[model samples]
Target: MASFKDFNLSRKVQDAINDMGFEEPSPIQASCIPLVLEGKEVIGQAQTGTGKTAAFGVPIVERAGTDRRVQALVLTPTRELAIQVAGEFRKIAKHKRVRSLPIYGGQSIVHQIRALQQGVQIVIGTPGRVLDHIRRGTLKLNSVQMVVLDEADEMLDMGFIEDIESILKETPDDRQTLLFSATFPSEVRRLSARYMKKPEHVTVNRGEMTVPLTDQVYYKVLERSKLESLCRIVDSEEVSLGIIFCRTKRGVDELVEALLARGYLVDGLHGDLSQAQRDRVMKRFRTSDIELLVATDVAARGIDVDNVTHVINYDLPQDPESYVHRIGRTGRAGKKGLAISLATPREFKLLKQIERETGAKMEAREVPSLADVAERQAEVWRNRIIEAIQGGSLGHFRAILGNVIDEYDPVDVACAALKIASAGELEKREEEDYNFGDTGAKPGMVRFFINVGRNANISPSDLVRTISEEAGVPGQTIGKIDIFDRFTFVEVEQESAPFVYEALRKSRINGSRVNLEPAKPRARR
Candidate 1:
């Protein structure tokens, strides 16, 4: 590992780095910082947590040198990454008087326009939002001397290649271009060939993509039963701090709602959220105020939390690269972490693809049973009791203990006290098995009816997607999506039912208005 000072960065930039407590440069940073400082075009292949932000950010800040105009432009695939990179730029340029602004959607364009008008030296923005400003004549890249594409492969995956090309064409031809991606896919190569001029390539930890300290596992589950299995596993495992990755923004929202209904301390992060909401959610998550963060791939790109104990793939990612990124959220800083995926039989091949691509063996795990949950709860309780006893503060309870022992045998008294102490947890564990109504649904769920079914040419998968998108209820929490001619019945958790109904009540499915309401139970003679 090389020290940050070895790069011979500007004194102010070095001061900022010292303030940030970055003693040593990461592999990517060590390899790329000096090249970037030399104004060389570079292509970096590295994962999210590889400290690439500072690698390019340091050089950009030091070299841009107090330019009031937009001297540097960083393009990111998602608004979250744009904001994150902008924050990093500001931190690295702290000693310097450079102003970096993050321009992305879900924030008022007028706000960004005002910032741009106020003379920002560095601009970090998502491709779409950057192009929007370009079209609006608010962002000018004519003076931009350095451009960076953070997570280049993710931008390619998001169909931002054209937008990137358009944005690049607008920048100064002599500007330095740095492209950083986890994987150098063919698209990335093509992109570099077209835009970059003899870029130096750097690959860090190329052969080892997955973190060694993470315990990777997958559970075989049916599509509809995934929610039940996820809940069971979460309850049994007692995940202290974790992230659940969903494939889409809708999936993220649905999972968040479903988890909330099930009484999990969770929040959602996705493109649909406002910048303020996203910031609030992230702040809470970092502080451990939110135990589980349900997020889409793009939304989670900027998460750098180290205390995350588990990463659950609520929905299997589309590619192996995404799988690596999702699991990389945990097992950070050489700490042991857990990465678990729930895959339907149909999606099992995708899981295999991830294993082959990442060179990681994912152990198969069974869905946690009720007894397993009970055992885990008991173990947790036992640990708490042992810790309390070891603290030697039970003297205050001696009088009560004596009274109980006088009435009953000592063993009986101990057993009674243990039962009383564990009563609430026992009740919660038992409630996990509570089925709702005649639909054989679990507790916290309700069956609902929606018009526009089979005649609308919709399948169960389509219905699940539609409901998830329209109702903001996760597909897993949606139970028994029965499609019939001109009518469909679906079960959603009771806590999310109102949201589902309100969202779908006036929504259209396949060009037909959907009338969604709670299903009326049939009368028995």
Candidate 2:
């Protein structure tokens, strides 16, 4: 738990860490930084979300002389991680006035080439692109004194191991190498044995689950149907602030666009955002101005929001440790939180591993039905009308209604007038649910909770019909319904909760919109 100052970091790096609100070093940083600074080849065993970036980052910034000859190179498994690690390096180097550029695919290779021509002291890139640059004669590692393999195991998993070795061959023979990963799999061990010179091994064990408060669940979704299923869940549930984790930056951008078309207040975060854009998005998310954040794994790291009510895995993570970090966003400060993951058949093995490692069972759930969506929309209207009635502030509209009443049969007129007043609120939501139908789930069921019950003038049929219409979850899969004075609960598959939550958030009952947070244990009998 030593501070950066204790580590004797340069004034510039220390100031930057302070500005970023970093106080004490994490265990990995505490152990690895010293070894790295001593010019030793080191293997760091650590999980994501631990501050390993700064561990090797500090020494590289300090040791990499400002001769501007590609003094350091950082290789990562994916483009997103490469960009992120590069950003961290630039922040530390800002005070020193050093230049570090990130090179990755799906970006303009010409632009990266131009930057390389302009003379960057450090380069960060994915293995494929880095090797591409090397073969194209754009990147020269002749002057490199330090090289880092961030997430070595991930590179192995993604079949980037061969590219990684080729990238290493280009660096100076006398250079320092640091390899970091959650697990040192056999391939990683082989790579180190071949490339590293008797590297010092540093392992830091995770002490306790920081996210014990997060209520975690999973939906058994198919690879093809996940998008629609996710939409239904979001429509049915009442989540305040949440994040959806996608494996790639491309996936993040794609989902953000899809969610926006469906009328959810959302934004995207990933390696593609400029530093300024990243800052702005985070500000809005933190201020509660935006309810949903779609992000890739690398871009979502270092995010420490405590109020996130939910974390959805739009794509499964590469490892069990990442699962822990993703869900850690919620259930903070003694408050209840939730995590829902969407898993396809091929990804179930990884899901099982995550469950085994965390000692938590993820409940399987079904897709929501179309009936569930409509019913939920109606409830939304009911709550709106009730709120208006109870607030007692319709003085201007009262005269207009009175005139309409005089012109028609009193009973028929009254019923028609009620519908007119409720139409506008219901219309906006109506267009929203149906327009996103393609994004709705197939016939299925899920479990959920309602903020209203018998005492508050609600019933099981009301809950069933509401969830069915809004989330597209069927009434058949909707299981035992429990009603209480101030709340109601229903049992459905765990998979359908996201869609159910989405529908419920938009739906209303009685005069008050029911607040359907993830239930605590079971609803009160």
Candidate 3:
């Protein structure tokens, strides 16, 4: 529909939509909202960034009574998304005074308890924390009229299917259930079959293909070196606009802070920001005030900037499908774009798998040097100066500049002027507490190093979990782990170097202390 008016929505919501600059409903919103408002069980197959939140949020806001009894529940895979969906509901229901609460991990349980005690009308949360509330009698779902499983496929991938089933059991049997996923994998349909009541099938095919114009590339680097390398590459490359995708909120915040410190025009976008903050960041990014946008994958969804020159995967995606979506953000509307991923030796295979799936070969590029970054900064200054000269703006500032030139060498004065014009304030922060040798993993990889090799009898999962627990890193981040009879090498974050070195310094793997250290770089085959 052209506008929310056609949907017969409340005047307040309509006004809010107009103010939010949403002139027309997206395909998923158009189809699913109608069914959901009709109190029908619905299954929506669409991408993460395709306005699914608004589709579900609108109906939930319009239908749920203002009784403040938690009439609606939205389940998301990540804590960031939990915060996001709840925020969206809160906004749409603003004029109605709907109370929505987001409950997730890594936050104070006491605070969540207090919020739940206030009797929210809508509750959005991750499955685990939601279950925690349910068990503690903090979240009563008897009044829940609608249950939405946002990013159902991701939850399933995360092995939360059982948790979802348990949560569904707690909801009212006749509740309107809406499940949305990017792709309808068999397991998703299987869950729909079991839980949903003949759900109305609505699929918005993202067309099984990534953008053709995006040039995909990857570099094999140590885990610790990823961020440093990213800074160098972004500084050197002629990227007018870019997005750096990380896996978590901490990553987004840390990277944004780091980029800001390095004198790059960058900002962070994730679930933690208030609506006002999100709007400000997006405004800056869209206006080209910020050159780099660092965000978690979920939060960066539905960002439709057309001039994005590059998409850097600071962290490799959990799957090949996600790789497609992450890179898809760049090459849009027939514009040539670049997609780069920082891969460790183990994750390189995963990159190969993505290439096979996309039927596109990725070029491996050398990391840009510090000298290259300085050259790029100079070039950018040169272009700005030329633009200023071509526009004939020198008349106003010529006298001041001429006096400065008379006091100093013309070349030195000109260079100082360019530095002042082009200099950016980048932010950096102290790195997180990660060990280099905690998992005995090699520096710059997600994998753990093991002492046992063919002779000692060790395997991947053992090392993965060992390091995963010790270093607080995920198994997914662990990269190619090589086992040797005398020693083993694992790839992990470069920042984790000291930790890993110290952790494994006296630790034993496969019943033996191993020599674990950063490995020598190898040429790609």
TM-score versus the correct structure, for each prediction: 0.71, 0.58, 0.60
The whole-model lDDT of each prediction reads 0.83, 0.76, 0.76
- Identify the runs in model 2 with alpha carbons over 4 angstroms from their true place: 206-309, 313-338, 342-353, 360-525
Which model is ahead, 2 or 3, in terms of TM-score? 3
Candidate 2, residues 1-525, lDDT tens digits: the string is 557788787788778778867778777788888889889999998644466788888889887677768999988776656766888888888788689999987788999999999898889888899999999999999999999988887778779988988888888889899999877678999999999998999876644343556677877665556787798777677789999999998888889998888777899998789867887898899899899999987787647665889899989888777887788667754568889998765565577788888677777766565557556767876786789889997988777778776887777975576678655423433322312222222234334557677777787787777666555556776777779887776766555565566556545665666777555442337
Best by lDDT: 1
Off by over 4 Å in 1: 135-137, 220-225, 236-238, 248-258, 269-283, 333-336, 364-369, 386-423, 427-525
Model 3 misplacement above 4 A? 208-233, 236-310, 314-319, 328-376, 383-409, 416-525
Per-prediction backbone clash count: 2, 47, 35
Worst 10 residues of 3 by lDDT: 424-433
Ranking by TM-score: 1, 3, 2
Worst 10 residues of 2 by lDDT: 431-440
Provide the lDDT at 468 for model 1. Answer: 69
